[model samples]
Target: MEFSSSLTLLNSKTPFLLEKRILLLEAILEHGSISKAAKAVPMSYKSAWDAINSINNLCDNTVVLRETGGIGGGGASITEYGKNLIQSYTILQKEHTKFLEKLTTLTDFNSGNLKSLQRFTMQISARNQILAKIEAINIDKVNANIVLKTKSNQRLVSSISKNSIENLVLEKNKEVLAIFKSNNVMISTNNVKGFSARNKIKGLINKLTFSEVSCEVNILINDTDVITSVITTEAAKELELKIGQEVYAIIKSSDIMIGN
Candidate 1:
C-alpha cells in the first residue's frame, strides 16, 4: 500500500487550518476576489466565506481583507499575515512528508506492531475542555497567571508554574485548551460577589442528572458551548437547580490546566 498524509494545524482541539482551506486562501490571493477564488477551488462562495470567517475567528490576527466599491465592485485580498501562513504551512507540509516517509520505512506492515503505537497517542480524562485565547500573561518568581477569553467573551484565569509557560510556549494571543475535571467545577445559584475562585461564569442549566449521591449539571454558557459540573445530590437539591435556571459555575485558577 502507498503511504500518504495530510497536514493540519489546530487551535486547541479545533481545526484551524486544512489543506483545502489553504488552497482556498491561495486561490483568493491569486484571483484577488472571493467569488473567483471560490470558483477556482470548486467550492461554494458561501463555503469560502465561512472558511475565512472561521480562520479569522480562531486566529489572533486577521488574515484576509475585504475591499468594496472598487472598479470591479468588491474584492478580497490576503493579508501579509495570511501569506506568511501559506509559507509556514508549505514548510510544515514538507517536514510532515519527510516524517511519514521515515516512519513508513521503520514499520513492518505484516508485524502488526502499529497497534502498539496507537497506545502512544495522548488522551485526556478531564471532562471539561474549553477553547480559549490567551489575552495576557503575568509571571512571578514561581507561577504565571494566564488570562484567557472564551468565544462567549467569558474571561478565565489560570495559574500555572512559570516553567510550564516556557515548556508550553504560552504567550499572548495564543489559542489554548483550558482543561479541568468536572468535579473541580462548583455550581452556585447566586452570583457570589468577592468569591475566592477566579472564575465565575453565569450560565443556564440545560441538563441535570442525579444518582444516589452525585449529580451532573450541564450549564449552557453560550449558544454552542456548555460547562459540566459534578456536585453532591444533596447540594444540588438544596440549591434547587433545574433546567432553564440561571446559575454560576465557579472554578479555581490553580485547578485549570492549559494545553496546546
Candidate 2:
C-alpha cells in the first residue's frame, strides 16, 4: 500500500469547506443507499442526514436522488452533480497526498515547522475581518492608538502596543485588517451616557440569530460592511433588537486587533 494523507479545501481570503460530505456522497454512490453509506463511514444516520442536508444547501442543483416508493422500494442514488463532486474530490485528495509526501522528504522538517505551517493555514476564531486603511495614529510610551477607515466612510480605532506599531510598519494609509471577536461587540438601541469605548459605529440590524445562551447579530454599516456581534440572549431581549432597527455597535480600542 502507498502512503497517504488528508486535506480540506479552504483559504484565508474566501473560506470554503468540503471533505466528509464528499466521502459520504462517494459512499452513497457505491452502496446506493444512505444508510449503507452511513454504515460504511461509521457515522450515525442522523449525522449522515445532516451532512447531506448541508451539502444540499450549498448547491443550487440536487446532488442526490431519493425515491420514496418505487418498484424496488425507497433507495438513494448519486446524481450527475454528486458524481462530478466525487471526481473532483478524488483528484484533489491525490494531489494533496502527493504534497504531504513531498513535505515529508524535506531535510529540515520538524514538529515546530509543521506547527508553524498549521497556524499559517488555520483560520482564527474571529468571524469579522474588515479591511481598513490607517487614517491616523497616536502614540504614547506604552500603547498606540490607530484610527482606521472603511470603504463606507465609517472609522474605527484600535489600540495596540508600541512594539506592534513598529513590527507591522503601521502608518497613515497603510492597509490593515481590523479584527475583533464577536463577543466583544456591545449592542445598544440608544446611546448610553458616559461610555468609555472609543468606537461606536451606528448601523441597521440586518440579521439576528438567537440561541439558548447567546445571540448573534449582524449589523449593516455603510450599506456593504456587516459587523457581527454575539451577546447574551438576555441582553438581546433587553435591547429589544429587531431587523431594520438602528443600533450602535460599541467596541473598545483595546478589543480591536490588527493584521497585515
Candidate 3:
C-alpha cells in the first residue's frame, strides 16, 4: 500500500536525517555509550557508530560529547542541542502518526472498494500488529480463492480474484503486511502434536462417509458444539479420527466476525 502524506519525512531523500538515525542518537545519549545504545536496539556496534557519524555530519553542531580515557573511562553524552532535537522529533513523530491514522479512517469510511479499504487498515492479531496484503487471487463462477502470504511467511486463503491481484501488482517476495483479527484462525492438529495453541476444544467423530463422487467427513468437537467438516475422507482417516475418539477444534481469534 502507498504511504500517507504524513509519512513523507520517512521517505525523504536526506538519508542521514531519518527517524531511525535520530532514534539511535537519542538512544546513545540515554545509554551514555555507542555500545550500550547498540545493545538497546539489538544492532551491531559498527552500525551504531555509523549512524552516529551520519547524524553528526547532518547537523552543524556536534550532538554528542565523547570523553576519552580517565578514571571513569570513555563515555558518551548528548549535548543540549541533541536533547532539544530529540524532543522536537518525538513531538513531530506523534503528530505524524495521528494525522496518518485519521486519514486512513476517513479513507475507509468513504471507499466502496472493500478490499482496497482493508489494505489501508491497521489491525492487530495474535498479539502482533500488522497490515493486510491481498495477493494472487483466482476467481471462478462458483467461488474465488486468493493466496495471501504475510511478512512472517503466514499464508491465508480468501475469496477474491486474478484481476484484482494483478491490479494490486502482487509479486513473489514483495514486502506486504497481513492484517487479521486474532479470532479468524481455524486450528486443527492433524499432523502437529505438542503445539501450544490456546483454543483447542476436544470432540468425537459422529459420522464417516466416503464416496467416489465427493468425499465428506463430519467430526464432532463437542456434544452440543460446532462440527468440523472435511472434504476428503482420506484426510479424515489419516487424522486417526474414529466415532468415539477425541479431536481438537482450532479457531483463530481473527476468524470470528460479527455483522448485521
- Give the per-residue lDDT digits (tens) of candidate 2, residues 147-192: 9998768999999999999899999998777999999999888786
How much is the lDDT of residue 211 in candidate 1?
Answer: 100
User: Model 3 scores what on Cα lDDT?
Assistant: 0.55
The residue-by-residue lDDT of candidate 1 on 97-196, one tens digit each, is 9988988888785454564355346488988888788999999988999999998889999999999998999989987778899999998888999889
lDDT of 1: 0.88
- Model 2 segments beyond 4 Å from truth? 1-122
Output the number of the lDDT-best candidate: 1
lDDT of 3 at 68: 59
User: Could you tell which candidate, 1 or 3, scores higher by TM-score?
Assistant: 1
Cand. 1 TM to true fold: 0.55
Count of clashing residue pairs in every prediction: 0, 0, 17
Write down the lDDT of every candidate, Cα atoms only: 0.88, 0.83, 0.55
- Candidate 3 TM-score to native: 0.40
Query: Could you tell me the lDDT of residue 17 within candidate 2?
Result: 44
Q: Residues 1-260, candidate 3: write the lDDT tens digits.
A: 33354333432465445666676777777788777777777678778767777667777898877765454335788999888878887888789888777767666543335544564464433322333344564567754455554433344454434454456565644434433342343335453466544334455667766675433434453244334444454555566556666555454423322110
- TM-score versus the correct structure, for each prediction: 0.55, 0.54, 0.40
User: What TM-score, to 2 decimals, does candidate 2 have?
Assistant: 0.54
